[model samples]
Target: MTTKATTDDTAVRTSVRVDAAPEHAFEVFTAGMDRWWTRAHHVQKGELKEIGVEPRAGGRLWEENDAGDVCTWGRVLTWDPPRTFAFSWLIGPNWQIPAEDAAGSRVTVTFTPTDTGTLVELVHDGFEVHGPGWEGVRGGVGSDGGWPAGLRQFAAAL
Candidate 1:
């Protein structure tokens, strides 16, 4: 994996290679998210049931718990199959959902065809939109347990 984040960069960037074609890789990331997402990163209490993207711009990025409660991670901002996807990240720095009026971060992921497989790149930015504790929010997402860990799990799943 390659991390492009620097102390001065506003975004957390990382990428990995997945042993699959762009189309297959994109499907696994969108429709098959639950298969690779870390259960330890569950957004709510109790068991995680599923995590998924709704497959279109303005659609939902959500997770459902075993108790049948569903949490919206955010709304999908861009959704071009076999290429790229972007979404809002609504969960706050405190690990809790904020009010409806609160601002959220943005995450963009792209898949490119490669000689051996697909090169998946992810960039998480817009932390300043969160206001007061924006730095903490940035740090948390830039951590190893954030995008890095998720990408590793994702690549290994394929």
Candidate 2:
């Protein structure tokens, strides 16, 4: 079964159970990020060539296009493999990178072992950082085509 709930106005939470171990689930979600990311969700004009998480705290979370242009999404805040991963989400309400990193939000994903599989929970918060158009940021991520759908794709990959 899938699960999703809003913790507050500023945050969106979603989860899914995957038929895989916590380690494997985490691997696919991070190391295999490009495989599950929604192609149409990107802000770039070129086709997405790769989506990457640099695997360390403070490392870059970015995506590259076919033209070799790179868009920096944010920085990794936490990288406890197979357990927890958190990163700054720097895309603004305009669907573009903001003028300052402070305008971004945060995303955290936790992997917990379950009897049947791994429970992967994701939370994207701090929408208020977007300031004037913060609601749009919150609404977009909480929409059906957002985190919930992304988690579904992640589960399907496993």
CA lDDT scores, all candidates in order: 0.83, 0.85
lDDT of 2: 0.85
Model 1, C-alpha of 140: deviation from truth (Å): 1.5
The digit string of per-residue lDDT tens for model 2 on 15-63 reads 8988899999999999988899987777677788889899999998888
Give residue 49's error in model 2 in angstroms. 1.7
Candidate 1 lDDT by residue in tens digits, 1-158: 34343333588888888779999989888888899998877777888888888889999888888999987878899999989999998877777745666577899999999998889999889988887778887888788887788888888777
Which 10-residue window of candidate 2 scores lowest in summed lDDT? 96-105
lDDT of 2 at 89: 87
For model 1, give the 10-residue run with minimal summed lDDT.
1-10
Which ranges in model 2 have alpha carbons more than 4 Å from their true place?
A: 5-7, 100-102
TM-score of each: 0.91, 0.93
